[model samples]
Target: MNPAEQAPSYRGASEHYLSPSRRDPVKVLSEEPVTRRVLTEALAALALPDDRPVDVLDIGSGTADGFSLLTRAADGDPAVVEEARLHYVGLDVDPEMVETAGEQVRSPSASFVHGDVRSGIPGGAFDLYLSCGVPYSHLTRDELVGALRSVLTAVAGRGRRAAVVVDVLGRYSVEWQPNWHLDRWDYAMSFFAGGGSGISEPMTFYDAPALTSVLDEAMAGTGATVVSRTAVDRSVLVGRHTATGTFNPGVPRFRTLVNDLLRDPASVDPADLRFTPATGGAPRDVLDWLAGFAARWNAALQPYTGAGPLDRDAAARLAHALLGLERAGGPGLGVGHSFTTTLVVDPA
Candidate 1:
């Protein structure tokens, strides 16, 4: 099958959903500080040369919010902030998106282009090839492999070490349990009605092994090699979105319920913990509900982590475990709402 055939074309309806003015929930959720941390960490992994300004190609760079986020991350570091000069090229398939992004993202080093990667990635010799907002998840495995090879080949031609970050949907997410087997699903964000324009787009999901397989195939002949792969954005809170009637009939009013629990765990009485088949209510206990979700995700992750089902106390254990660490995104707590497997590739 043609790779482009498998990808979702976000026109008209979808275009409105990506508008920065609308405060798109998915856009807001994906661009959360925690989520943006993944990109910042990937930037740090580049170990870029100080001798020259870094050239970056951001694929599917919607609204170019990520460019702004990256700049903020660099600015936070006094040591490298002034030392690092960046030239960013934001590429998106949507002409409107490119135009909109061009307006929002302004920098002496940043430029915007309207193009599709299936055809070709514009510019060349970029020190960093970045893809966020699960852009690769729109392509089929074959399409993804082909696209990777194209960019890697271009970077290889330059004969310089570079890093590529591909962010996609996670397979075992509670948001789409009913459609997990199929690689593609219509992701609904009805809550962002203003942004969505009453339309959803088909998106593909991936596991680590599948991602690794494609990356390996893409780099086979090229000088690029995978240095490391890190999983980030293990969101324990996103499954609550399931209650919004956008996903399967599982958790009704999950966000409201989770908010109650977050505010006062004791306020949720024991009676509330019972699942109601008649109403399709989530588990009465918030932790138990989250644990069940975690267990299901763990089962899907078994092939990659070789770990058994996570327990009801998993979140608490993870929280306690995290206190000892000085950082986040070390390894997902196995409860991410959407996981990003950032493969650090070196095109030396």
Candidate 2:
């Protein structure tokens, strides 16, 4: 067995964070208009038997954030969610996360499971598999490819039209984009202040090509064909999985700037790179979409420091600007570390 199979996932960590609390702002984002719009558009034509219910699995459903949001949406507005019961399984490699998922979170239709997604996924004939927040970057390239294949296979059990939706790093995003920023705060979200005790291999970024290759391999493994694949306004890729092929095109930004810099890093100084400032726009658009696009995060992160979830709104202006950069890549705040990208995948 590979190391991923041996690694215990801390699925409970996420549940603890998302537990019953108005303090759970992340859950708030998961429940917002932006997230729902994305999901609604993504799952529109899957056709999972509206007369009754359908089973959906979040292979790496951290903290039940996505589930909580979906559950609330189903309750808050059942018209969009046609299923009688939204059966869901949230799996993670860590035991604590699974434990937390079970204790908190109120949804009769949902259950938490302890399993390593790095190896083979759980045995369930699920109609939909939802993975959010580009979690695949937590694994190595080989492991990522393997994991994608595993997800498809798990959802494929004895069925012809199983679909898997995932958010991951764009391979084209790796080079010269000032990859790999140190993230202690978010790491603390796991509650392991120093990150887990296990010997961790530091994570890296991917370029566009590598991201595409993983999709190719995943499609081949599931024996599913790609029904749809498109970069949703630069930050997300939405694709439908079928019995033929799948195409995944992750977000791209710094890459466009990197090319410009490579041609002339000296001339690329100052205004060539602009650390986006927080500015507001339509509430329906993702608040952080633009902030995540900045070529450099240091300066852009200033207003966000010492702030909690509620404070993120203060940074909305910055996020709105970054959203513009998403459409037109640029630069800024350059000590070390930069760039954020997202990808989505569905089974054929």
Query: Which numbered prediction scores highest in lDDT against the true structure?
Result: 1
TM-score of 1: 0.70
Which candidate tops TM-score? 1
lDDT of 1 by residue, 116-156 (tens): 78888886788778876677877778878888898888877
State in Å the error of residue 292, model 2: 14
Per-residue lDDT over 44-68 for candidate 2, one digit per residue giving the tens place of the 0 to 100 score: 6465555657677776666676676
lDDT values of the candidates?
Answer: 0.58, 0.46
Q: Give residue 155's error in model 1 in angstroms.
A: 2.4
lDDT of 2 at 169: 41
Span of ten consecutive residues with least summed lDDT in model 1: 318-327
**C-alpha root-mean-square deviation, each candidate:** 8.8, 12.6
> For model 1, what is the alpha-carbon lDDT of residue 276?
29
- Candidate 1 stretches greater than 4 Å from native: 1-31, 73-84, 193-196, 252-335
Per-residue error at 167 for model 2, in Å? Answer: 1.3
